[model samples]
Target: MRQAARSYSVQLAIIGSGMAGFAASVFALDRGIKTAQVGNTGAVAYTTGYLDLLGGDQHSLLTDPWRALVELRQHEPRHPLARIGEQEIRTALARFTHAVSEMGIAYTSPGETNLMALSPAGTLKPTCSVPRTMLPGIEAMTQGAPTLIVDFDGLKGFSAAELVANLRDSWPELRAARIAFPDLPPGQVYPEVMARALEVSTNRDRVAELIRPLIGNAGAVGVPAVLGMHNPDRVQQALQQLLGVPLFEIPTIPPAVPGIRLREMFEQCFPERGLTLVPQQKVTRIDLTDAKLRLSLRDSYGEVEILAQAAVLATGRFLSGGLFAGRNGIRETLLDIPVTQPAARSEWYRERYFDRRGHPLNRAGIEVDDHFRPLDAAGRRLDPRLFAAGILLAHQDWTRQRCGAGVAIASAYQAVKGAVEVIGQGSAATRG
Candidate 1:
């Protein structure tokens, strides 16, 4: 039998298909480059639909994100912010987000500002929507006028009564209320079920029926539980039409499917562009020898070795294991890239996981240069062929600025550009 010649050579190999990976693919393709995408979680399935931007009016971000990264490393010391500069960070964000919209995903607004999150509880939290910062968007809401706490009967994880009491104690002027969604199934504690139902539900009439009587005297409707699921715009409009009151949403416990959905939307567009996708695949080991990057991985298709000219690590923090924590504390996985961290993992987080004091668990992650490349322990570029993006870049908190998506978009764009530059002009730059 005659042998068929190899059909294609990869120009890029992206490890994860989350927001960062998807942005990497999009940025490369927009530049007329061929790329491969691989990862599980399917990106879009588990997240809220909106891109988080920096929110709190108080926690004004550093005018320059790159300089801010530098400041972040100084304040915390465990963040990675080597030669990364300001202009490149901004350029990456603009280019990537514009590319995302070009590919059909919407970012709602422009400029490096906050995106409002409509929580499962029909209340709105203007979260600092950027990646890796210290300011809490939830706490920022207290500055708003006479805030109210709202909840659904069967909502789990988010305690309306507890949060309300806390808010009232913190700000006595804050008003609160509890309203039950009649349609929520019994024993359904996760507010997102009702939230999603509210998002795309054709049951505006039914929803109005339940909401009209409850807000008769309240100036605003506060939903501390799932207010709308996938269709916040429609649900909010429907609720407003029925009750004639302003509505807000509050975030509950995570596995935030609404957030996951946002990730999914980004992932779906990659394959159409011919990027390789490998789901449920874990990168078991990585070796950089003779200037070639080798990755050992295991997935449903079984174990395989992937060789490439360049790689982008978007595996995320301890939760995702892209960066691992041990008894001695944080270290980079796979390639052993230099990761920033506190002396101990115990020092990584607050005594209470829920302490809200802001722990290093939320911080101590990765550090990178202007182009988002990993640096070594001595603060030198570890691998010229490798780049880092997303939460792995280190410094700045997403929960603080509500800029997670923005940072992911920005950093991913820059990293892809740097990768393209590294490979230079060559047809067979990457090995499949």
Candidate 2:
């Protein structure tokens, strides 16, 4: 028998597994390009699951994310979001959100105005779109309808009382309750386990039984987002029908159900749809000198290789090992690409911790050209076949601007668009 094949060829290679990397693969697949995605899949789980556009500035929140995008272009033209036209951004976000929905998790479409969504702690956050399971909470809070927010006894990080305490002023009818998780171990229960357990109908039934009695006169009942890891929509619907009221999920905390659902959904669905998903492994080396770019990394079995016509570098920021910070300065981890950062490490941050300008270090990353190709030190394209996306691109601090997911999806779209152009015709011909 032949040994397991260790090498594959594709039209596009995506170099990260975070939102941007995943978005690139989705867009490529939509374009009918053969694609492969490889990266460590941890950071996606740490996200709060709110897809923010230009939700706010350092000082205050913005009602109109599109309007914010317009102003962003005027001031920060180099910002990744600002560089892409609004319509393109809109289309890209809608496509990404729709693709994700089709994969499994249902999401509200991006709208004209940002929705004021709920945070784990009772504070409201302006976001472009939210998971379907969490939409009812936004609706309940906006209407000031009587609602009961419940938490499990041993669950950590999410507190029903904390959410209500902070939100009571705005939504006085909002109340809080805590109950023991049915059949859970005695101590330190996690949201992941709870969510997975909820995949079973009996488990959902046990939860609904406990929540129904406490939801008296409430228009909706909200619970921690442990509504089934695989099919949250089904689990949520079942709970709602059983409770006789609208049901919603509140974001628990980072590394909680919302983000886990996205990562898991990709793992489950991407392979079946003709996408090569290399989960939880780093691409050790990339060779771009050849016409067909080559990427290599080792798995438990042995060395694995991918040959692609074009590649997108969406390896996120420092946390995900996309950028490395050292004694000299920060550098792109994968290709050692030019990093646009402060002159010295001393200037990385402001003298004060909360300076409105944010840290200069946050703005540092590989700069990309109009087509999203990584630019060299003299601002020339590093290689026509290589492009960059996600937080690793320079000139904007995504965290403070509230455009992380927006940047990821939009840049991935543009990068993949550029890659498709390159794939259809040689980069030299496209340039010519």
Candidate 3:
């Protein structure tokens, strides 16, 4: 392959490509800001397509997530969501879901109450919004509608029988079956491969034909999230038409179809929308000065440099390599930004792994101010041009609280807003 330009310039540079990083870029694009996003689409492919906003805590599930946010702010004032206004949080999440739906893979808009969707393990997930392809599942489970759930012959980790056995008490009408994936050489079947195959019309036809005979008097069909990778909503529509029933998807194992669809969507859509995207690449280092921000990274061809007026650090937690937990303590990976963690390693966890209160180590992350700017020991912003977002901001555990997507999307909005302000002030100084 040939080499491209070694240097580029933009008004804003986003440091990660997880939900937060991608959300920042989307927010920037909406404002017509020239933006460049560089990093792996991190931790995103490990998610279900559902967008959650404070689903619940460790003890109880919250039906009214908005009301729960009010309580959350009072108790956890330093939480990232607490730092943001409720209206802003609502608008930011709504705008993000709308943007992605327009791009592809339609998502239901965030609403007042959390929607109950089924997990691969047959547990109910209380999320704010879910993909339209999976929305039928909520209705099917709630109404006890006769739904036939199918698992593949070779696909592992998702067992239709197990799902039915677990949910039988609440949903007695649920039935389980299995079918062979059509037209492929397969030792082990993967959701990603099955999804891409379904993208072909013939494959959809075959799948629907196979599923139709099994759906005796059933009103709906649920399958492992093996809907078409690129066009899931349309694929669901076509298959439902063929089977004469409402069709929906249940989330599969991690690195499953839902996350894969999103990762591919960002890679394909970002560049088309005039956002400079270096997909699947990470920034080696970032130099933030009083004057400007410089990001350096290397790709397959060669090294590349990016200069921008402002940057958003949304690289995520240890799973994404944004924070490193050393034997001594946890350290921020990219900028060496201070992490607000327990003083000693011994304080990291509790005696019980399933402790309802959760572990302190889960809350370890950087601290940020009202404007989403990371702060120093003195509670001062690290730099006028730097901001942080997502799970990397301290105070609450995303997994336990069920606010991962909310924190990522809302904080990205505030971070991008701060960056825009910084960039605009710089432009004003040039005019002056």
TM-score for predicted model 1 compared with the true structure: 0.71
**C-alpha lDDT of candidate 3 relative to the true structure:** 0.91
Q: TM-score rank, highest first? A: 3, 2, 1
Displacement of residue 156 (Cα, Å) in model 1 is 1.6
Scored against the true structure, residue 55 in model 1 reaches a CA lDDT of: 42
Question: Looking at model 2, which ten-residue stretch has the lowest summed lDDT?
Answer: 1-10
Give the top-scoring candidate (lDDT): 3
Best by TM-score: 3
**Residue 19 error for model 2, in Å?**
0.4
Q: After aligning candidate 2 to the native by TM-score, how far in Å is the CA of 367 from where it should be?
A: 0.2
lDDT of 2 by residue, 1-432 (tens): 545549988889999999999889889989998899998865788887889888878788888999899899998899999999888999999999999898889999999999998888888888999999999989888899999999998898999999999988889998889889999987899999998898888988888889888988899999888898988998999889999999988887887788888988887788898999888899988997886898999888888989999999999998899999999999887788999999999999999887878889989989999999999899999999899999998888877887889999999999999999889896466578
User: Across residues 218-332, which tens digit of lDDT does each residue of candidate 1 receive?
Assistant: 5555554344543354565576667675665454556764455445545566667766666557777767785557776765445566667778888766556677777876777
Tens-digit per-residue lDDT, 160-257, candidate 3? 99999999999999999999999766567899989989888899999888999999978999999998999999999988889988999999989878
